[model samples]
Target: MSDNDSQKRAQFLAAYDEQLRTDAETPSAIKVIVQGPLRLVTFLNGRGFITYKNLGGADQAAIQRLVPEAMAYYQADAEIIRVEWKTRGHDHAPGMHEALIDNGFIRDEQESIMIGEASALAVDVPLPEGVTLRQVTEETDVRAMSAMQDEVFGDPVSDDMAEALLRRLAIDPGMELWVAEVEGRMVTAGRLELVPGTKFAGIWGGATREEWRGRGIYRALTAARARSALNHGKLLIHSDSTEFSRPILERSGLLKVSTTTPYYWKR
Candidate 1:
């Protein structure tokens, strides 16, 4: 790719990645890395999730065996039956796609993995009338954020997940959730996370109410978080967005570097 194309891809990926913090939802698919023969982290919500760190040089066949074991782990739990295996395009994920497809995994739509300079995303966005932004720090604010996020995503209300997010916030996981409130109601929301070891910050769960759509609140919220990311010394901002978000981020000068497809399987 030419320099302009490369930069364009990078910008989009950076805008989609959310930061790491206690308030970050574990989503049952997040596995806390631990020591073992095959260290795996599984997150179980309505579905199962499997994420592993750099495998200890495990071959493809050994890696292939992991699914059944993981399936068994969540199989008995009534809450989980399906699982998503998130793959990074840059990772040496040998046999990952084949293994998943062989196990009845269906792939979701591919999304561009866009990453770019945070400064590029710090452009100004004008806020709509009676709407303002704030950083959520308290448990109540966290729950409210989670509730708004669910509504934005079109998921059923999940108090369990909402309460869980509040608990993480109470632990003070350094994650920041921001909302564009109209009058006293949250009409749009987003989260910013500064990853500890990487030069990146992620913005996630950006949503706006149907009636509140397209008045510049989402863009303004993104700009606010982009400014926040700069204060933390973050050089980049990233997010994995749906079609709705991808276009907005693209217009903001973020690049879409590569694509990520989540293939899911059920036990």
Candidate 2:
């Protein structure tokens, strides 16, 4: 890899770590916005969710303290269930994965941190002759997008996920949904979140109709989203890709720097 490539990757990782610290998790289980010299993100998701930019600057005692406080915050509510601590291998986080394991939090499968220059992904791609693309932000359109995405991803249809996404869109948080249609039927769709307070935007739920693969529709939609991200001043684009989407993203110049996986803990 070239020096420029190395620098870009480092910058992308640094920004990612910092964004995790500052992003407002959600309305779920009151939020505790912790102030940290490095980067820290704590969320109340039943148990507790803690992830920091890196552990290079923190001692073991500091991390241990953080865990108890985080647990207490989540435990305050009887409804809270379980907590997870997300870790990144490329981060300056020393002994973090070890610490979580020591504390009874298990590690999950590593997911690739795919990042690339926005410009490289801004090329124009034409959809198949019969298909076209449209943006979905309205409630009905959002539901359709969600349903199609669920089918493409092999997840059970979830009205709750649709409701949550609609709620988020209602706030006009700059989240966008795009769809590919053939003869007036929705075939594939995805969501792009223009995360506020960060120089990066994320593409999620990029699903293609199994029969519609390799028709260039999904790529065109992704390009359209990339152009939008660039207009929003986001130079870096990121996604947690699977086998299907990873190759397509790699073809667009995004590198898989690391992996992330969520391990479930049930009450």
Task: Judging by TM-score against the true structure, name the best candidate.
Answer: 2
Candidate 2 Cα outliers beyond 4 Å, as residue runs: 24-30, 35-48, 56-69, 92-107
Worst 10 residues of 1 by lDDT: 20-29
Relative to the true structure, how large is the alpha-carbon lDDT of every model? Answer: 0.70, 0.71
TM-score of candidate 1 against the unseen true structure: 0.77
lDDT of 2 at 12: 72
lDDT of 2 by residue, 118-215 (tens): 88899988777888888887788888888888888778998867887777777655688888899878987887778777777788888988999987
Q: Give the poorly placed runs of model 1, Cα more than 4 Å off.
A: 7-39, 43-48, 52-66, 69-82, 89-98, 265-267
With candidate 1 superimposed using the best TM-score fit, by how many Å does residue 175's alpha carbon deviate from the native? 0.3
lDDT tens digits by residue: candidate 1, 52-143:
43455667887688656665666666767666766656555678787778777887887766566789889888777688999877777777
lDDT of 2: 0.71
Could you estimate the TM-score for every candidate? 0.77, 0.81
Candidate 2: RMSD to truth: 3.4
